[model samples]
Target: MTGPEHLSGTDRVAEVIKDIDADIIINIQGDEPMIDPAIVNQLIDTFEDGYVEMATVASTVIDNFDYVNPNSVKVMIDGNGFASAFRRETKDFEIGGYYRHVGMYGYRKEILLQFTKLDQTKNEATFNLEQLRAWTMEFQ
Candidate 1:
């Protein structure tokens, strides 16, 4: 077998999934070593329609008034459960009811490839979010 080539995390994942025939691909963060298996199952189970091109896990944000912390990424989901935006501050909703994005993602194989080809956006560079590059390209 060939040795692992040096690539960015997104590139590595995209390459691995390029030939997958699965209906859904789960993208979990490598840093989250202790992530619950139940959460993984939950994300997989959410693909009821088979049309969910992308999805992510989130939990109720319980942090008190400290929305400025860059470590916490706030998210707003539409009524259809699609993510509208992500940011460090509580932009659209009240801080108490915000949901913190869990960093795990689910996508179709085709979407994953498309994501890998997109260039990083200005906002993404500003926030240092690689995922934002994919998001900005409307891949998910």
Candidate 2:
């Protein structure tokens, strides 16, 4: 199940499981060698509500440098706990609620496939944040 080189981690998982039957799919970035198991549990717990189709985690940015670094993606979560936006620039920190985007996600199988089928959105291409594509789809 090979995907395009430009496909993001979430997109790749969708492609990989196109043939497999599954209720849920979890995507943990390969770069995160020390991902905590508890985070996975938390993601699973989010699904217990039964209405969640997609989810991810975020933590407060402890280092100012990391917060400002364009390499460390920042996330803006809505009051409902769904991600509202993602950005790599620091200029918007003044808007306040900024958190380091954890490079992990859990998706309902159908939602994952739908995510991959959606076209890249303007913000997504601008920030190189694939999750933004799902954001545009109103998955939040």
Candidate 3:
């Protein structure tokens, strides 16, 4: 894989994944120094199905107002467990109901490769979300 130019740590990570051979790659946020081994195991378990292109965990949101804050991005999953969309605010919200998107992500090798080649979209650039670039190409 070629070296990244002016890429953030997350983008550089996608570049490194291009040359790996593993079926699934788990990206753990380094900032969470106190993460439990059990949580790591659970993350790996979530991707047991070979077809899962990507997977991540989410904890129930205790605050409804936080769900509308742009700093606190929200994610919704499809029936198949794939991420359907991510945004700051979502409609049809009941009080005390939300799911905070965890920073961890598991991805298949091919999907990771494809992710590195996609162009950034308007929403992606505007929101400064690298994940949107991959999902724009249906890679996520």
Candidate 2 per-residue lDDT, tens place, 43-102, comes to 878888888999988887536876678888888877977776788876653446788888
TM-score of each: 0.78, 0.90, 0.74
Which order, best to worst by lDDT?
A: 2, 1, 3
lDDT per prediction? 0.72, 0.81, 0.67
Q: List the residue pairs that clash in candidate 3.
A: none
lDDT by residue for model 3 (1-140), tens: 54747234456777777666688788876655666778778888876766667666665643666676777667766687666777766676532445677677777767766665666688787876666765677764
Q: Which scores better on lDDT, 2 or 3?
A: 2
Best by lDDT: 2
Off by over 4 Å in 1: 1-8, 91-94
Off by over 4 Å in 3: 1-8, 18-21, 90-97
Worst 10 residues of 3 by lDDT: 1-10
Worst 10 residues of 1 by lDDT: 1-10
On TM-score, who's better, 1 or 3?
1
What are the per-residue Cα lDDT tens digits for candidate 1 across 1-140? Answer: 22275234666777877776786889887766777899999988887767676678887744655466778787767787777777776654465556777878887777777776766689877876666776677654
